[model samples]
Target: MPRRTGWRVCSVPGCPEFSDRGGKCDDHRREAEQRRGTARQRGYGREHETRFRPAVLARDPICVCPGCPQCSDPDSACARPSEHADHWPLSKRDLIERGLDHNDPKRGRGLCGLCHASSTAREQPGTFGLH
Candidate 1:
């Protein structure tokens, strides 16, 4: 039997580092963290708030982060003071591929800011290219 190398290139585009965890390298991890930080700072826009508030409230204000079941109560399990009404249904690339016209109210979905930013980043041409 031959020894099999488990190392692989990072999943993040343009990165050169190698890793076995999700194919992401240290640089990608740092880039992702920076992007998340930027997204958190921007917060959700007025359109998202006005349009998705009712839907999010109706479903019980929550963080919506995978593996996290916390509500949106700042004083409770949900430490985050604000919860973003993320586009749950459509992905960023899906929106881009479908064009802006497809991002109609009828196609929107809810998600937390963190998850939303992460999803949106996937559609960008390069890492942290959402600007």
Candidate 2:
């Protein structure tokens, strides 16, 4: 069943805290980050930092979430400046599995910090206590 549109208890199995952001509460969120390790450890390497990320950001200077909420109209592209070069449609892991260059700028879109965090929390495995 789909979760209702409101705050809920923390996603960590026995935790009693509440959260309105990612499913995990603050403590679990911190713990999960510690477990997840650094960006380099997760495969974001020098090529990503020096090439892919900059290229994507230069190509898309604004947030590109469909119907981005940062704009006055939720049906419009966001006016907020982009802060992240995000992998899209195909996740980095998916691209690698398919033998495509995971750091290709064409595989990414620019997103504001808010949009990036929201999408990461929602879509990334092991986030929100799913793993």
Candidate 3:
């Protein structure tokens, strides 16, 4: 087994705790998650879990991001399995305000967890740069 080593300062802006996790320390991690709210609070309720998510995943069993290309091109796309059903070209809030079905599978795309997190951090305001 590989050894677990290395530590960095906690990412809570002057918290002054060295963490092997690369983000917040254990004490602060829980606090951060609580502040972020639960999945239902974030609008991923039953419909999203049961209908929209399953359909999108079925349609795209693999990551569809440009970085995860399916062709022979090496620098095109990823080969990671899809793990998230993401809203494309619009967020759930944007769809709702426009009187659209926010959970419609037609408006979703499949992405790997890494791709989804990266995309979310880049596209969603106030997600990054606050810390």
Candidate 4:
């Protein structure tokens, strides 16, 4: 007979998801994590999530990848619904040090899931600080 280890399902009513990390499923866990992020991850405070992020989202309702190398053709650009409100050119660290509100989303840019993933992976992965 094989030895047994136990994992539990999410505590949310009717949820069948399971995880070894906690009582919540991965989705719920991630949701809670986002809500409980450190100051920096949560963009320093309420202003970032409540004010800045919403404003940016409203300003750029769709992705603006103008057929660049990472995107498609200018004539037929990927104007997908933006999933991220990113700090332009500057990274999160840069913004934190210089102050998150200094620009008020001036350089903010909207990006789709694909664009956001590519940009973050390229800028934040193994070769970080190399650029």
Candidate 5:
């Protein structure tokens, strides 16, 4: 008969104990948890922003640029249909002063990439009125 082996040790570098699922020791597992928590706090851990997606869905999927209508085309070689979520009516200084959150529904709206670029350029001194 074959002899049974004991619990497998953690595979994470520098870890010395076993984990049933993650291959991490308890200390490393806790560290990994801490890292995940920090990432969530910083807004990089989740796939969807809380408000942006629903708001965009509620509105037409088309770009909101005046005189220009386009759909989202994530992979299009052409620029018109590419979607960009942009902050409206708010200057960079305003956003910095208010510390606007990117996910805030009241602070953002959808636009085409070209329109977004144009709006950004309009905010620059030399580019104003050019678009």
Candidate 6:
């Protein structure tokens, strides 16, 4: 049946850790714990981190934002190192609706934090009718 919550030995066989947080002991929290509602719940799991993220980073090592902080000129390049792998369409809402496929090589853009934030903000429905 269900193991009552409190304190117990680690679920891992022959392990010695324990916790009251859940079934898993302290050491296994990162691997065993699942956030209530987020991309993880929606299928963005360890596979994405272990495989998809690295592949994406390797594919595009630089931010591809165009005229990022300001669009004064179309040819401007941010050239900042990519700190985030952003969706090509640049909307997480759309990405969720479209179902995130971390494996889709062409679906993302390597973006710096500033550029990614700016682009995402611009995609909102009220920014200069950009939606």
The whole-model lDDT of each prediction reads 0.54, 0.83, 0.82, 0.70, 0.57, 0.66
Q: What are the per-residue Cα lDDT tens digits for candidate 2 across 66-129?
A: 7764456888777689999999978777898899998889999999998887778768844532
lDDT of each residue in 23-124, candidate 5, tens digit only: 567777787666656635644234335565457534525556664423254343233443765656674346657877555556666676777776686665
Candidate 2 collision pairs: none
- Model 2: residues >4 Å from true position, as ranges? 1-29, 69-71, 125-131
Considering TM-score, which of the candidate structures 4 and 6 is the better prediction for this target? Answer: 4
TM-score of each predicted structure versus truth: 0.34, 0.72, 0.83, 0.56, 0.39, 0.52
TM-score of decoy 2: 0.72
Q: How would the candidate models be sorted by lDDT, starting from the highest?
A: 2, 3, 4, 6, 5, 1
Report how far off residue 131 is in candidate 5 (Å): 20
Better lDDT candidate (1, 2): 2
- lDDT per residue for candidate 3 within 17-62, as digits (tens), equals 8889688888899887887787887778999999999999999898
Native-to-model Cα distance after best TM-score fit, residue 8 in candidate 1, in Å: 0.9
Ordered by TM-score, highest first, the candidates read 3, 2, 4, 6, 5, 1
Point out the worst 10-residue segment of candidate 4 by lDDT: 122-131
Error of 1 at 105 (Å): 9.6
Residue 14, model 3, lDDT: 79
Q: Write one digit per residue (lDDT tens) for candidate 1, span 19-130.
A: 8665578778887777667543644455545655556544535554443333444343333433555444664446557765332445554456664565566545465534
What is candidate 2's local distance difference test score? 0.83
lDDT for each residue of candidate 4 in 1-131, tens digit (9 for 90 to 100): 34455788787789988877656788987776666766565445676677667777789889875663455465665778988887777876677688665337775788888877777776778542232
Per-residue lDDT over 10-109 for candidate 6, one digit per residue giving the tens place of the 0 to 100 score: 7778878887875567766665434334566655678666766676677778878876764455588777788876657635456667777644656777
